[model samples]
Target: MKSLLDLLKTKGPRDAREGAESNLFTTAFASKLAQGQSAVPWEARAVEVAATRLPKSRGTRLLQSVWAQDPYMSHLSSDRVDRMQRFFAFATISPNRDLIRQDEYGSFMIVLLSGTIGVDRRQPWGEHLRLAETRPGDILGEMSLLDSGIRFSTCTTLTDCEVAVLSAEAMDEMMEHDAPLAASLVALLARKLSLRLRVVSSRLSDNPHG
Candidate 1:
């Protein structure tokens, strides 16, 4: 089970981007700018144009914010913060309703930036069972990112929503460059996972059927 970084490294340089599970930048309008495609979505077009002007440091900042907000970030040293500031890439996703499905590759760390999303498990009886509502600042998709596992459940937006995505490679880079930050991040991830497990356990105790 190779991590996303290992998978990316194995690709030919030209094919790196193509290997991504989702085109975080591909919006409705990028086709219009293509050689023969028409009517590219403006939002997609804007991301393309913005990509050229934004500096790498700015991208790093966006990712740092996600890391800092994690309860685990409290353990990080200032030096680690500086190192994190040095590396990392950021991308945003604004998916339409029910756009992302279950059992997909859990490739990135997603921070809910806005709106609401429902986390649910499909059951033998029906779908939409064991649902949890998530709001801004909530971190999702981490279970799979920290471990090479498929998505544990489905996440569907209740309204148009935004998510900040940071690749595993970027996270690995942060760890290599800043030991404290890496430790802090791992601890943060652990804490979040532990909390989530407790929540699940409590629910099960209340109603094992769930």
Candidate 2:
């Protein structure tokens, strides 16, 4: 049987023009999601963060400490963490914002530096099913981030949130410039994803109603 990494890695731009294709994907993806498509709407109201860029040197050690404790993230050396900090864009998002909306096509994933997010699914008959709530050091939308797939659940910030966003463009650049670090990152993300899926499977198997 194919391992989970093999299954997840079977995703990427379907064409040779990596830059053009990723740009087109993001532009169209954002435009479509803006025109009234969200698991919950935040973009249509023009709440999009106007600040597009952030300095890399801010709050380094605090985030570094948190990452060092994560089982998968611990594999990254301090140098790799420096590389990651330089690569990712940091943002402070306010409460009640949707970091990810179900079924929207987006090219980035969020790493929470602080605050809480609720991950939930909207059922067919109009009820919201809470899957999990995330905290500091947690990652949101990474499955889609890795595979460029549609988001399976909506992730909404429940408090003022600080995040590091890793974009597809950044990922591609990383892969080109630092192949080993990129491989480590992909492996790290894959292991985290695989662990989550295993926990979910275990829960479902244990549930009498499931």
Candidate 3:
């Protein structure tokens, strides 16, 4: 199988790169999932391992701590926790960079391990309306993963930030093979959605004239 980097190089045009890479990765990842192997590729693992040999980043350590205490992850067994950790790939975004853009199609969710991000909605006039600022331990893109739709908001880093990303294919494979994990995930997502709705309701109530 071709490495993801190799596949990415074959895709033409800088503007199309991100989409092409995402599609290629998802297809290859889904194929591995179908074979009952871990969704993360060996090449990806090798890269992560190498990166971690240097002193681990503060964000990485923070993410490890969150996995131990966050309600969304705390219920997992040791083995499941280990497996879940492996499924994620670490990412860092520079300050002012958009982590996700509104209307972009995505098949992955992100856990904000460190720093903050601003979630903004693009108005018809192209001005951005700030919706929320996400802090560490928050999860973004769950709605997209659940519905397979375009991103609803643009998530941009307020400062340098680190995140752990879990692809939809990996999540689906985990749900298919582990009922308990699936239940936990669904419950967590439901709770997150409920919280978000409450916030929206409160905002609407305050802006009744709009």
Kindly report which residue stretches of model 3 are placed more than 4 angstroms away from their true locations once superposed.
1-61, 67-79, 125-127, 204-209
Tens digit of per-residue lDDT, candidate 2, span 27-128: 444555667653222233224643233345654564676688898898898888887676677777788877788877667788888789898876666666
At residue 62, candidate 1 shows an lDDT of: 45
Misplaced by over 4 Å in model 2 are 1-55, 201-210
Q: Choose the strongest candidate by lDDT.
A: 2
What tens digits encode model 3's per-residue C-alpha lDDT throughout 15-129?
Answer: 2334434454355445545666443332353354332221234445666677667665566555555545644667665677666668766567778887899998766666657
Local accuracy of candidate 1 as per-residue lDDT tens digits, 100-197: 34665434555665568788777655645645888666777777556644566777667655555545555555544443454455566668888987
Error of 1 at 87 (Å): 5.0
Q: Please state the error at residue 145 of candidate 1 in Å.
A: 1.0
Ranking by TM-score: 2, 3, 1
Candidate 1, residue 68: how far the Cα is off, in Å: 6.7
Q: Give lDDT: candidate 1, residue 176.
A: 43
Q: List the residue pairs that clash in candidate 3.
A: none
lDDT of each: 0.53, 0.67, 0.61
Question: After aligning candidate 1 to the native by TM-score, how far in Å is the CA of 1 from where it should be?
Answer: 17
lDDT of 1 at 106: 37
